[model samples]
Target chain A: MSSRVEILNDGGYRSDGRRQYELRDIDIDLSQQGTADGCCTITHGLTQVLVTVFGPKEAKMRSQTLHDRAVINVEMNVLPFSTGERRRRARADRRILELAATIKSTFEPVVQTTLYPRSQIDIFVQVLQQDGGLLHACINATTLALISAGIPMTDFVCAVSGGVHSTSPLLDLTTLEENDLPHMTVAVMPRTGKVTLVALETRLHVDRFADIFRLAGDAGQALHKEMKRAVKSRATRLVGAMETGMKPPMGGADAFERDVVMEDKMSF
Target chain B: MISFASFPVPSQNETQGMTRHHPDVEDDIDMDEGFEEGFHRLTSPGEPLTSSQAFMRGHGTYIDNDEVISSVAGTVERVNKLISVRAVRSRYNPEVGDLVVGRITEVQPRRWKVDANSRQDAVLMLSSVNLPGGVQRRKLESDELQMRTFFEEGDLLVAEVQAFFADGAMSLHTRSLRYGKLRNGQLVTVPPALIRRLKSHFLSLPCGVDLILGLNGYIWASKHVKQSEQEGEEAFDAEAVYSNKNDDIDDATRLAISRVSNIIRILAAHFIPLTDTLLLDAYEWAVEQEGDVKDLLQADIGDAMIATIAARD
Candidate 1:
């Protein structure tokens, strides 16, 4: 991860024109899928994640089932076409394994797993398009997918990465931002405001750990608000499907057929 | 889902009096002929929160943390701060009173299942379809079927959200003259939430373009429909709304409209997230100066995307 010329401007703005602890443009699409039990699409800078949840039903695999607690299954895949440069068309790589683990660990504690004992909940997240924060996005998407599925949860898990870039602690680094910054992404549950999952890909000064965690946790909370709002908006629009039969459009055909009313003015 | 009105060009008093509950007339409804085209650059809340904002969405609350707090003190909906209580838990399921537009996915015995971009198939019962004559009530006859065979698989439609059953599936309706199948024109879909709580459907004309906006944030561009309301209080139904009116609107008008649409489509293709106001202003400025236009596209759109488009051009 080169291209990080520590913009020697110290205490100044970082790349992409951000100050210390600044997040990127994080718009979200809460209900991008029609078939999934729950769904959300998160875009962190250029990074995009589409998450779908299928069940709190019977666990598909016998080997993974737990006797008393609801088991969680997390899958994260990076689409080959997501990157700017052409890459392999293979399935999920090693980085995805770590991410899947991060998502599982981050969410397991928050989900009220006791509600559905003997059942397995599956959170499937795909990186439809990728740019940066590949892992962070998967974590956030999983939380949304869980919410959409209406599984019990204590609070939202919001995640963002912060790193030392251009001599500044850059928050929510993009692909370009990540290249130069030695950073770690943190997933936090804002209700408790605690970091449940933290993946530090590069070594950094240990003294500033507290500050980094604080910035990333707050950033995660901000992201949670956005994802939550988007999902609610979509869920509202969805109710349109349920409200049928109220108008009675052609109901009176059996009742009013012979009522004195027939005028064929201009049949064309 | 194309809106036909613009954001309100409110008098100073109207603008000042604007509260969260007292939405502009265009809010929660489509823009008929009554809309104003204008623009205002509103500042974003502190914190570049595109990431955390995503999480805030699910809970019915958003961050004002560390800096920006709630301007509107209401139940915090994590998804959308603008409209509270719409989706924290399910509020209004598909109901008959709601005016909605959807697409046809399957046709069956006396019914069709529509993909309203929802969880399940929205059933369009045969009995819910509106027949032509008001008093001539009869079974949906063969002649009536042939006359209005407007939809099929893949066909887009505009209907109302009617009601739901015990199983949580939706039943849709197309009773009025305004609601029915759509054809000929394009169908642009944004997140449905954007449609439900739009502050204004009127495209701000800070750059001067007549924009017909669907309640769903689907924008239709045409120079012929320039200078605000072309007609007064004349509401356009689904049938007429999708008509290729741009073709008949006039040549110079078509040219301008097409140019604007072209730019927007290109921007959308690039996946440039935009507000209606921002896109119109940017396109106008880019075209106003020919040399600048080239630089503009090149700047935001990487060279590779530009090259891909240029090869086709």
Candidate 2:
């Protein structure tokens, strides 16, 4: 596809007329009904991610390692009906493998796995429908799942996939957008505003790396704030349902508590 | 052909936004084909259920007899703050003692979590279950979970409420024969609210055969209780006098009976398909056995169901 510069440009903006650094309309909630430890449903444009968490309990027999740290087990279950026409089941596909591996590696530094030594936490992320910002949606949903599972984390890891289109870098690239261009996913701990993880899948002009990287980090920051409020509110609502004699209430942010909250709030 | 004159258009959200119980709720409760809608009786049988009506205190109190009461009519039993009926009601909440059909979702170590008769997921402890070989135990051994097969995900079970824990969630038991994994039958979930609890789960359909599920919603399919079987039937009239004499009957008991009656009524209306499956299957099986169908029909059914069927046939 040639960069027609005219077809790619409209209203001095993208097809959707979204200014650069502008996020898509996002709908996030826990009000919906679904069976999962913790479930978060996010709709960014048409992209939909249903994230569910299962643990913080004793580790499963298989995943338990001699090391004291809790291992994060992430499984991405994308429904066949998620995409148009039909989508095939993923049986250890490279994409899923890469996704799982990347998530585990990225989250290891954030999740307070040492708190629940020998225990395993299972996070299930499903992309029911994809438009763009799947990595961002995944991170957002994973944050909610972790909160739902009552797992501790250092900060909310908010991420977004972006690409440099016209002269500026785009934020939260959808599949249609990513297909014809270079893409990069940047996950950052919103509170610290540090890029915790970055994956540039396709070739991009070397010089534009700095610019694309900055925009993704900015998207991640914006996303982390949104995800933080969501998790804090969800945790607030879980007050009455807590079985153990109440979790020390989360209100004012202390140093360690803030770090834990931020990490738990951010994920991919 | 169906006539529009007889059929009334249902209102929107007629079933939703039911604020637990609200005054001015005297709209006609279309009894037939209304099990899926959540409703539970909040009153005991023979307990003059009331509705909002401004009556005068003439020589005590009386219904405004002068009013042409066409929009309302049921057994005119109560003339209190509001009017309710003894005919049939629906279930609204999870009662402690009724039998329910539920799905086992999570199998935990000491207890298996079940979707209580609705409302919330309740716990079904190993102690509550009827374990094999009649043994008393607390902790569940790995083998026990395999042998008796307590419950795996997606298993529909019929269990009784042993008790309710502090959280309003119930503790279910399958110790009795009626309580266990449901098999070879279709499941139809009615709102836990609309079931009307009768003293007995045994119901006699217009078709003549009687079915007794227990008050706990457990189904005991059999010919209706013979008139002779109810020969010494204590009239619910007895219950009226009993309730009056025993004002101390805990609110829990009254609430429980109301809930039970409501469940029964909903089941009767909505379980038509379930009943059809049961009867049609049995009828088809008997017909398939070939030999003498008469003997098969007469074998399990008493003379009365036979007589009713013959008459209908």
Which candidate ranks first by DockQ, i.e. highest? 1
Q: What is the overall TM-score of model 1 with all chains considered together?
A: 0.45
lDDT of candidates 1 onward, in order: 0.54, 0.51
Put down candidate 1 lDDT per residue, B12-70, tens digits, no spaces: 88436534333345335322222112211111112122344333333222343422222
TM-score of each candidate? 0.45, 0.45
- Could you list the iRMS of every candidate? 17.1, 28.1
Docking class of 1: incorrect
Error of 2 at B59 (Å): 70
Worst 10 residues of 2 chain A by lDDT: A259-268
Q: TM-score of candidate 1's chain B against its reference?
A: 0.46
